[model samples]
Target: MNYFFSHFHVYRSSNMILLLFLLVLHQQHYFIKPIYAYSRVEDLAINCGTESNSIVLANKRIWIGDATNSKHFSVLESSPQKNQSSISVATPHRDDPYGTSRISHYEFTYSIHGVTPGHKFIKLHFNPASYPNFHPSKSVFSVKAGPYTLLRDFNASGAAQEHRDHHHHSDPNKILLIEYQHCIKVEPGQNLTLTFIPNTTHKDSYAFVNGIEVMSLFKYHDQCNKQKKSRFRFSEVVHHEESCMNCSPSAQPPPSQTKPASISGGVLYCVIAVSVFISMSSIFLLCIWVWRNSRMKHKAKMELIYEETTNSRKSSITLASGNSCRCFSIIEISAATINFDDIFVVGVGGFGKVYKGYIDDGTKPIAIKRFIPENGVQGVQEFKNEVEMLSQLSHPHLVPLIGYCNDEDDMIIVYDFMANGTLRDHLYGTCNTPLSWKQRLKICIGAGLGLEYLHSGAKFKIIHRDVKTSNILLDEEWVAKVSDFGLSKIGPNGESKFHVSTEVKGSLGYLDPEYSKTKRLTHKSDVYSFGVVLLEVLCGRAPLLRKVEGPKRCLVEWARSCQSEGPHAIDQMVDPFIRGKIVQECLSKFVEMALNCVVHEGNQRPSMGQVVEGLELALQLQLKSED
Candidate 1:
């Protein structure tokens, strides 16, 4: 009896260990449950433009036709009298549910009802090819699911071409199919509505879709919540002439009926009770373990990052006002930006979007730059550099750094807002009022002063690696402030070291030819970029015009050629808005200074101080001319 009991104890211990091991593996996603294992509360697949009762695809999904729609959905058209039509494709790709598509010249909507509320995967299928009367190029549209804008001014042909180019396909005429997938949460009892609107800005534009699928996934709640915390909120609904049609009770499909299991009441009750208790106990223990492990890992990671940042040299630098830069929490940043709503977006750049936000109880206006790590390490390094450099340096002509947020995986920087926007906005783009010749001169002088300070006034010689009109911001008082220091670099510290040997990184067309060839960075490289900006301000044209051909494509080369031709040619190249406003002497001096800064050799370029003096002289000459 003792031997038998000892054997039983060993057996039970081994089984319990195995069970714990399996549970840990499941928590780590080592064991992926099959699709059929999920309790799918809702599944919808529509074969658009088809009249068939049912079609089974290769993926084992059953799709019903939307043409003879039952109570599940109702389609509303912008023009009920004209009515949108359906067309069949000549060649359909393999595994395609149906070759037909519903095409619309105007806006349309689909209201789907009776969907069990949760996070759903929304899929939209598109075939970029010519139809009977519709062409792929003209198929430009926007798609919206409730308040979320899935696609804005989307062009299927361009997307398909990009897909082909990405795969290195030489054949440009290949028919390509594309699918866009998005995940959205639907509150309980709320219906799902999808709107398709043609790009009204483009004439003769249309919208088309081949299929639509909406299915519930079991593990979407955590993912959706995380996404919401990281990204901006959904945009408002798109305004259109047609209104969305609501589904009535009679239009909804009949409730699904499930058969009851036949078993002895007493035995079934006991079995269910035991199963529920065991399952709940196991799940509760697993949750605790997972939570504790994740919490410990996250805490350690954050502490390491904080230690590194605090130990950095730049972090010790304090402002002249006796105030150091504050480290903001994610909650504070989110509150200031209103959870990064779309309406607060002021501008978009290579790194990410900039939001106009108010902080300190709406008293302090700030500009928040959210760094999105799209390029992985490069983006992260840039974010760190921006924080380090800006915190160490301060000047009246430089945009002030308010604070930063490096919580979790997010990287954000806050700055003093520039109410007047960028210099490029007034020079060529959309600003209705054009700056006078004198105003332009003053702005250039201010910007040059800022660069001079960075190059000489700072503790170490700093190079504004990227300098252009867009980076030159204007304030309410028209003071030109240099912004965007993500690419800025500290130049050689001692007199013996003339340049920093580093990889070339700057905007194209503004990049110095000598630096590009030698991989040597110096203040002269910034002078070269600033020279390009000088010409940009004078001609009111971009640094490089991709659409233009020959020397004219590059503003620097074209300006050089025009200067060689004489003052007459230079006058012709001037921006028409300020063509005759510039004095002859001022224009000649300005052109000479710009050309000297952009010479082929870095050593031949003017120093930042010299550039500042030249700009100041030009400004004085402009004032004399105005008098």
Candidate 2:
């Protein structure tokens, strides 16, 4: 009886403790608060988080304001891994109304690449959250100079809200409002990308202007711009005519006006018929003359421009596929580069430099790569191998070869120009704008898909010997397109491995140590390079880090050490700016995939197909949680 009583008491006590904890948790969660502003509509004040409160500048910090008290306001831009210091603005007076507060006029500085002079002012009045009657017929922001001038604001508040919260349509705090304006340029083709968070508002808010959305192709005809302008002019004429009619005196038939009405109508009809005939005839004649002149002039001008462009663009290739491949005349290549001006140079590599050039009457822009030629048949073998292999493969991720131009003086391979540049530039600051988290995730997935396609989807086995961030080019949508096939290897039919005992060639930090020593290249070698790139994505560190102790500091070595050290070890390895956002499961799987790719033995490493699968899984997991 004593033992039974003791056991029953203990069980009852545990149940009571759990019940008490549950009640406390329920109460705390149920009473959770939301932001509220009780001030009159006219009393509210709003401001942008920019230096000098000017919306014309690049760096906009953070948007923050208070409804009631004149408290110190703060905004912070911190490293991803560490807590950021607050940038506070002290209130001059404590007891001031919302609109009358000194917070109405403010200035601050935020640094991206450097400290740029800019401003953040309250350009508009009203908040989307509190002010239910907020509506603006028109809003405009002016630029200092250049082709971009004034931008007309458009409605972007709806899509902004819908997309931000996984289409749940329940997020009250999400700001769906987007202000927009038109972009102007002098190029033949107009390239525009409008990117905004889904769910909020505004259809006119473009993604490209904010540097958040990028894309690849803009295939507009040269005459399209002129045609569009003409259409706009025609529409303006019609609108003006309608507006004028409304303002004009009414033309009513009076009691004595019958005699003149028939004569006036007849005159007007005759005049309209004559004007139409003359206008049509003149337009036809002008079109014919312009076409003839442009065609004749274009042929001669194009040849001359091609000659000058190709000379400067085509750098000398040391290794030639002489006799084994077709070679063009030096004059032909010279016509492609327009005398190799500095503006044509796109990138430079150890073997040679790449240039942007237009060929075939300036209708196409091709990537002209000049490489060092080799002395023997191996050079010919490599060139033939790359071309033959590439011809057989077709995928959206891989760069397609239009053709190759090889002269005795220079060699050039043509590929479609990737407008958004490289993955390296996007992540680590290229041209100016830094990539957002959303862009980075999209880039990773695209790159993985490309690798997956090459490893398994391709007709024959093709290995991307140089798989680094630099090799990954981004399209307009920030989609990753892998390039650089100079060092690629093709496998024999039905045979996965074609044992090629050749000298190892690849980027320094990305080279597989085992392959380097053994001189046996395989698909696993490409896998190893991919692992280094994965590390870069996770840690935001360069493939090669300086070793304080010796010259042996590789990213893989450091990652291996971190794994055994502790969970925080990987934390230390992560890029400081983005540490908080790194999902643990995703990080773990990424690390695991990378390590599998970097195994001591080639056979042990996971294939590129598997690596891509793991990365996709990791990406899906991250997206689901963030949603």
Candidate 3:
């Protein structure tokens, strides 16, 4: 009886310990947490356009129009991308937003930057609905992203027809958009450069893209190694307008190597290609159709000048502050520029070339901009807009517009020559000497003042559509001035709404995600760009440089990451060259102000005036450090 009692007591004690252990685990589940080794991140969904914003399509957000060392296709410069007809293609199931706009060139390259680099999925969307004048056969094009050649001499319409055959004759007319997605390994901090080259054999001789989507999946190249056979594999998503959506699963794998099907090798390869093309083309048609209906109704958007007359009364534009724009006659401008001579060529930009010239009896040095029509539709629009915006707006921070000449085909404007070139040239660009910390702060202050003027100083609010380091020009006195006005647009007109929906325009790294998504043009968009400039000025880095490491590659991403880890972490983010020159408090304040400007939500961003105020505080701190 004693042995039995002892054994029972031991068993009960063991059971009690087990119950206690369970209780601890349950309590820990609610209270104390174990550090997890891995986290399941949300899949990245990136949709962008070349010119139009996210509203161009309900699916796209991350617009990609501005490119370094690239030419933008004018909407009418090259024949239309497709036959945009509702009768032929049927109304898009969804209300398409892009209208009938597409960017095309003989050879165009797009560099998609500031992305989560890894093995990500890419969906190249196209609207190949041909115009009546364009030849469907001439739609042949090729695409190369990184080292991967996704398409070669591809006849978009032919691919769509094959897609139709593959789909067993689905609603052919309803198809407008087509999507083709493939998995590829991305090196850390690598910008995806997509080269679209028109096939020489094709008569159309131009390439275009209406929409693009990028999804970041795994964050390592090894993801490709793990699934080598399937890495290059792709699936298709076909969106015919807003309503009709269809998705085709991955194409069946090619016949086995060891035990092939009874089909001949040539036949087998052809069959495999057909199957893949069928899938790709179906999805591709879905992407192309959205523009046809909306485009037909909005053809006059190009003619519409969404602007304000800064100089409405006379030849000389009178500014609100009484600054006058001296309009030059065509004869006078010709004498000044010497007929747009190559010898006078000073700089080149998205649409035209700049020439150093002389006016006022060859006494005053000036920069003359000559537009190239073939560059794209934005060229003419930019020229007109620049003249109008520059004439009306005047500030110490803005580059002074001396005069403009619009005589027949001679479209040109003259401005005070910026002897120091771009602010970019001074910061690790052409200029050899690194700007001192004090000098840098002064320049930042000047830039902020210029942006502030654009946002509030003028009678009408203006948003500089393109704000980047390169656009900030430095004059002979080392005074920084905001220059480019081609992308500038009038801010929202309605008092009720905070933003105006406009076509997306801006550089890759500096683009505001909020504006990219909502197509809302606001003063806040410029703030985000200024934040990028602040980071660049502090770090002496390019906005997006593939040559750098993954973490430090994109200035915006790198700074944001560093800021999140506290001010000490920002130490690592600052430029090594400028580290000792910076005061800790000033540097921290500057970074805090910058990060605040670039917040994902526009409302959270401070105005240019606020940014200026913060800079003033930073200046005081810098002065204290110097003392």
Candidate 4:
């Protein structure tokens, strides 16, 4: 009896130890298993509508074509024809995935299997081109991923045209490719299927795709965790996905995977109870550490960006007495702008929305420019540059900087409100009355003076790189002021420097051909852009009228052609509103000066000072003709 009792005691002790080990593993199973499974999964990129071999891009990403017959994806369509011809002109993308696309006249589906269960990034590539008998305009279709609607009645050609028009791209032959991206969640054992349905309501409508990319969210999270320098957060991507899904939860996991609960004895219950208490305590402590660490890191990053911007402008700020550019808090800005209500939005541009708000307790009016957060480093640089440049320089013709707000993720600039809005608003695209001949000449003179001040009168020579009508704002008295110094650059201080070699950046159609070709920016580059603005003022139209056909499509080319046809041909091109109002002599002198500013060589283009003087002369002639 003593021997048997001793052996039973040893067996019970061994059972207890094994039970504790099993309990610890059960507590961590949910967290550890998913991570391990995610690491094993890989990203996928497929070239659609092609039977060609796999393609290797410069970025070292291998893209498998549909012809590979990979188990990862299967197409419902039996025969998908490849794009007959490649894009004839140079495209924006470095890779040529757009060369071969899968075009379908009827509905089709792509069943993608083996995707790991998690949030995934879906990228659909499209090249809007005329494929064989398929017209680009007729390629209107809807896309769906399971229960989610990715796109509805989407027109690729219209979208491409809109993009071209927005950027003022004058080249009609330039191809515009598009890549639509979305984030989605996949449940366990659920295959991702993409369906492309043609719009049956529209006659001859079809669907096409150039490429498809499926990337796991864990891949981004893993990279983010590995690289301390990366600013992107996995949480932010998940937030974006949630927003894309309209804040709806993902579909429930398959019911077949659900397991039944089994009854346990009193001893097993006691083991589970102890494990639950210990596991909850450990998880709580870990979460606290992670949250604190993330907060500290985020704070440090924001401070770094702020410090860099402040340090770069220290010299400029010191020169300007430090108080010239005030710093406003986000709270004050939000209160003044009514929390950025749509009704308060006075203007919208590439940077962001401009809100007209009351500051200093509704006594003072201010124009607040909110920078788009997604603009990232480029937007930050612009914000810094504008503040640095504007703080040091002050002139009546230049818009006054009231203050700025760099609170948290918001980068905002406060400026003196212009009652009359932009010069473009008055020139066209509005019902505002056209300015008289003298008024137009005076506005031109004021704008020219602003550009001249930037080129010569400033403490340091500055070049207003983006000189366009839209950047010229008019005040209550109709006085023109140069605005948007984000693109401005400090030019050669003396004759010794000559030019600043930099990447070309300006609105298309107004970009200086010489500067674009050589990548050498100079004061004459601004002069060329101002010349385009001058043409805009004279013709009362945009720099490029996409609707106009042939040579008449481009204002500059059409103007040059008219000038070549003799002096009489030039008069026919004047804006009808000021047709007879302009003195012939004044018009001739103005046209000659404007043309001189846009000459082929920078050396041939007239200086900003000369432009100011010539405009003043034209104004004098107009006044003399009135007398």
Candidate 5:
């Protein structure tokens, strides 16, 4: 029982010790304070005698010694207790005014392990070695004259290893001896302070701590962009302002010495130079492209306009048998209508509206019939045909043709204006002011003369293919003038009656039954259509009245029934307002002319010339009866 208790006690003690060691290590790792390391260089002072030797001594250089010199260097590491371990020192070299030697450099390291972190204090000492021929100087040598520091919270093993490498590599006679006695203790969250002295401009020699070669702070440029090439410069040292605690965050810290002092200025110069070159090149190419394009476009536009004007001028000539037509522009028509105001509106047609306008040089107003052609392909040909035929033909009762204008899209014909409007308007409109028998006879005679001219008087006997009350216009004195030559055709022969085979064309009510059947045209075709208009003038009703049903209500059928039913039916056939106002002999003669024109057989119908003669004699007889 005693042995078992002894072994148990030993085991418990061992475990407690292990536990205590682990706790100590844990506290050191988690709660130890930090210290920042730094290095610097300084100058030392020495004195000589009052003679010239004093000046020489004042100018004398001081340096770390070679291997043969008896100045040893070392570092000490320990806790707050009096225990210490020596670290090795490295060789140094004599300082020369013009030579930067490699041997004078040395480094020392020490770890502040197990030391409390606070404002730690350090002491450094130096022992000067005397030469056999030299005397002691008034000034004492100080190791603190060079860069020195005290550190806490560092790796003790690492510091010791670095010190060993530095000494082992150095020559034995060149080791400098150093003496120091100081202690520092720190706890957590404390900082270690280090102080250093530096050489001034007056010093002949300087000292520095051996450490890693750090890059110097780079100089910043402040020259304007334009002055970079000519105004930039560099100096040996650069100056900057540091904050009391830390470098100001807003301030731009100095750059490392990896780049040369002139690097920024050179980069800016190269960029500016390249940018100017590129800008000049781009401008030159752009100018050339624009110039070429402008020249080419100008040439093309001029060519197009020239071609259009040439084609228009060529089309102006009247052709006797070709389909080419000349057209006037909308601008010219706009000018003619004075911008299509209400005042210039003369009449309306099936396709488009008409307006009365005068040419630029003329005072007489001309009726301009404007229409979009149903068959656009044949529009220009039809326009030229009408202009050529109308300009060449002249007759007293025909609507006289004036000059025309040609522009790209619009085609217009100018004609002498009729002040009294169309016969359809007069016979059917509210202005039903009953025409005197004398005026009716005259209107019939004038209209018959216009048809006679179209049938025989023109250089080429033409066919007034479309003849209706609307196609006839009146002058201020009520002189009937044949108009609307859109469907009119010139005889194939110049002066003889020629039948030009064509498609069926004529107004519905006045269309010749024989022509609509056989599609053949002759002069008597005009006579059949005229017969319809004559009946409309005599009676105020249209030839085909929608009021009656079936095909027999036509004026010709009703007029034919008049003769069979006798003169009493004739009185009803005429307008009631103009009944009995017309003389019996004149009415009979006028009805005879109309009957002869509308004969079913084209060969049996009287010519327009013959109709004109009959209408004139009837007009004279009616005038006599009125007197």
Candidate 6:
């Protein structure tokens, strides 16, 4: 069966004739083929040193080996190394796919453009022999083509079957040429990107590609798409009459004699056509009515989202993924927030001011962070990202997004109010509570769990690029829940790259130095920032203090220096408020773990899973000291 996808708009010239042609075509199952023309096939070759319009390396590409002479798929730069793989492939030219080898530590992307939108095929060529030290399992990687994930934690070596065990067909001389195919739909004005990212779940992970090729698929499918079919269906009746000449007179059709196309029968044909049009119109309206009724039933109201009464806080409501979130009107949010009163204001940050609002006689209070008008479109996008991430990710350690409001100048997100507020407050902000050793341990552990879950527990790994003490909140029961996913990005194995390699954006002193220098983001970047937060918890100094002089102003640097001086010197780095409360054994390990995280290199830092384990041990030691 041939499918003809037509443009929704039809021709206005010869309107009646065009309608008649379409009617006949629809009845006869005919197709109107589009004129086919396509650009020549283009090949992208990467040498890893130079920037060709077509090649993608980690950060830069090599110029000497580029052979394709076509636009190169661009990617971030990696350290250039000589070819030393065990298997060798024949190279015909400088722009050939097998030219030079470039490697990436985490993830990178290649942008392909300069062509029309439609189905385009990409062939990714890989040379796994470049990684001799790591086993096949450690070589898992992924590739994303637009919204489609072409590969996921794919094992190139095993899938290639070059290391076959004692097989007759297996020849040692045969080189394993691993290539992947993907057909992507690139829309108008949108450049297609093929991202290569290492799998984070595996150990000794890295991504590498020797070559890539991009080609237009237009001409390949043109033969079938350009086939034209005849539109006339009027001849079968005329042929039937001749064949029926030998039959009896009683079987002679009187309607055929009258002929429906005759002028006398025009009124009857008009009535039949009008009746068919009315029937179609009625069916269309019925479908619309049913769709509207379904939406009305699925959507919930703001009050119904989570019920609150004068007696007690309402039961926490969990929404099914399909549930339509409550869309609050401006009047309702204003009433709940007391007309955006300053008295209700709880916190203020880069995005906007957050106000604590209550419903049903203050029984259930919620935190409302409204966008500042100055933020413009960026504020709206952040609000959208937060709502999207928070709704998809639901954990006890994560602050739940209760609802949101978008009306007039407002773009606000309502979260489950953390009565105790930010962890940064207890350590350094206005609250300044002298939190006991156990309480501090609990808060840090909770935050670590949140980060750990984000890295591996949720449906997708999330890189909370802005992981700082201020983003960690304490609920009424003092359970720490990580809040604010505005800067969070889906991590490795996503349709995008494994790690989001973008501009180095995060709070000062909390930003990862490696990420800042290379602009390559990973889950470890969050670990580096969390290490700074850990230092804040231990020493109670801000990440960057303007008053302090020299390196002492940076808390992590100061703590690292004290930590190198051994146990006696670490005592001085402990927060004076909780100095005597910390156990000697606990302090040593805690400081060591935090220092381990702050190390200049990202790979050296432990994952949040390991961080949680270390913090738990420290907490246990602190309890023993109390005993």
**Per-prediction TM-score, please?**
0.53, 0.48, 0.49, 0.52, 0.47, 0.49
Global fold similarity of model 5 (TM-score):
0.47
Q: Model 4 segments beyond 4 Å from truth? A: 1-319
Worst 10 residues of 6 by lDDT: 230-239
Pairwise lDDT winner, candidates 1 and 4? 1
In candidate 5, stretches whose alpha carbon ends up further than 4 angstroms from where it belongs are 1-330, 359-362, 373-375, 492-498, 550-552
Best by lDDT: 1
Instruction: Write the residue-wise lDDT of candidate 4 on 90-136 in tens digits.
Output: 22333546657777767878888777776666778887776776788
Off by over 4 Å in 6: 1-320, 360-362, 494-498
Report the alpha-carbon TM-score of model 3 versus the true structure. 0.49
Best by TM-score: 1
lDDT of 5 by residue, 1-627 (tens): 564456456556656865897899999977774321112121221111011111124545343321122222222222233322211132122222101111111221222223232323233323232322222131111133113323222222233233334223233344332223232333366423222222233222212222111111101101101111111011111112333865679777777867564978898998787667556555655665697799999888767655654454465656445333334566655655655544345566654567766554434456787654433434455566667777766677788776566554456776777877677766643222456667777887888898888777777788888889888888777888888777888755634635677888788789999988887788878899999888888876677755566643688888888878899988888877788888899989998898888889888998888888998989888878767
lDDT of each: 0.76, 0.52, 0.66, 0.75, 0.55, 0.67
Clashes of each: 0, 66, 37, 0, 22, 25
How do the residues 265-315 of candidate 1 rate in per-residue lDDT, one tens digit apiece? 767997687667556555666776798799999888767665554444233
Off by over 4 Å in 1: 1-322
lDDT of 2 by residue, 347-466 (tens): 777656787655565566566776544212334444545555565666788876666665553455667767666777654422124466556666776787787777668766677788
lDDT of 6: 0.67
lDDT, candidate 3, 363-424, per-residue tens: 46688888764444356567777888887877999999987776644567788888767777
User: Comparing candidate 1 with candidate 2, which one achieves the higher TM-score?
Assistant: 1
In candidate 6 the C-alpha lDDT for residue 140 amounts to 78
Candidate 2 Cα outliers beyond 4 Å, as residue runs: 1-144, 147-333, 360-363, 372-383, 429-431, 492-499, 546-552
Candidate 4 worst ten-residue window by lDDT: 230-239
| Deviation in Å, model 2, residue 150 alpha carbon | 14
